[model samples]
Target chain A: MARIVVEVMPKPEILDPQGKAVAGALPRLGFTEFAAVRQGKRFELEVEGEANEEVLDQARKAASEVLSNPVIEDVVSVHWARES
Target chain B: MARIVVEVMPKPEILDPQGKAVAGALPRLGFTEFAAVRQGKRFELEVEGEANEEVLDQARKAASEVLSNPVIEDVVSVHWARES
Candidate 1:
């Protein structure tokens, strides 16, 4: 089986409320050197298919269409590798 | 700086539409031996603080409070390591 990984994150210009909440609490937690925080999601997929080139592209398309929010986020990438 | 990594995933019973879409496409991509697909998110934070015990806990709390969806997901874990 092949495993494909994808990461989804909010755009830099977009405001991530989740990130902001974490950033706001950093000072109380004792880390006082951060100016910002951003939150994102990662997906690992066990692709069931022959090790073909098209498999990776299919995975990417699936991610773009259904896995991530395009308007508020960008820079989604897919990494594919054989199971070890 | 301390780097903290966290992974968030939906509970096993929760249906991941993204995963289902990917699973549905496996045959078209050339593989026909898979039964399911699941997705998750990973976060890497450049925690700016002294390498202290509380720093790690802080990062975890930050993730739990803001980075993950507790209602739909569980098994959120945080990993802390110093920059080499």
Candidate 2:
């Protein structure tokens, strides 16, 4: 078994109020010094069967199609991690 | 400048309908090899100044205090990657 990690993030042009909200609250919390922050989604898929190129290809499809909205979001990448 | 990544995941016992929703939709879309799926938050913090321990520590504090909900979510880890 292996794991596929799909990272879905909002397009750069899209306004991320959630990230901004957290960024705004950071300085107040005394963790100042950061210029910007972007919040996105991380998906962990536990593959029960084989974790091969076929699975990787499907994972990529799932990442772009099911995990993210191309109109508003950008899937940074989909990669395989060792099964833990 | 550097980047700080904060990964926040819901507790194991917590219900993750979003992840389940995605997982449910995947098979319909022809990606049906995963046993389970979990979705969480991935935060990217771009630091303007040096990416030192001080900055890393501050980033950790920001990650835990502002980026994650201690009650329902668990911050998996905080780490630094090369500035891109």
lDDT, candidate 1, A1-84, per-residue tens: 667767787877888887787777767775564556667777767756574667677667766766677888764567764355
Residue clash pairs of candidate 1: A42-B40, A42-B41, A49-B31
Task: Report the lDDT tens digits of candidate 2 across residue range A1-84.
Answer: 588888888898999999998888888888778888999999998887987898888888888888899999998868886455
Candidate 2 lDDT for residue B52: 82
Q: Which parts of model 2 are misplaced by more than 4 Å?
A: none
Give the runs in model 1 whose Cα sits over 4 Å from its true position: A81-84, B1-6, B10-35, B44-84
Q: Go through the candidates in order and give the C-alpha RMSD of each one to the true structure.
A: 5.0, 1.5
TM-score of chain A of 1: 0.84
Task: Provide backbone clash counts, one per model.
Answer: 3, 0
TM-score of each: 0.60, 0.92
Interface DockQ of each model: 0.31, 0.86
- Indicate which candidate wins on DockQ: 2
What's the lDDT for all of these models? 0.68, 0.85
Candidate 1 lDDT by residue in tens digits, B54-75: 7667667666766677888764
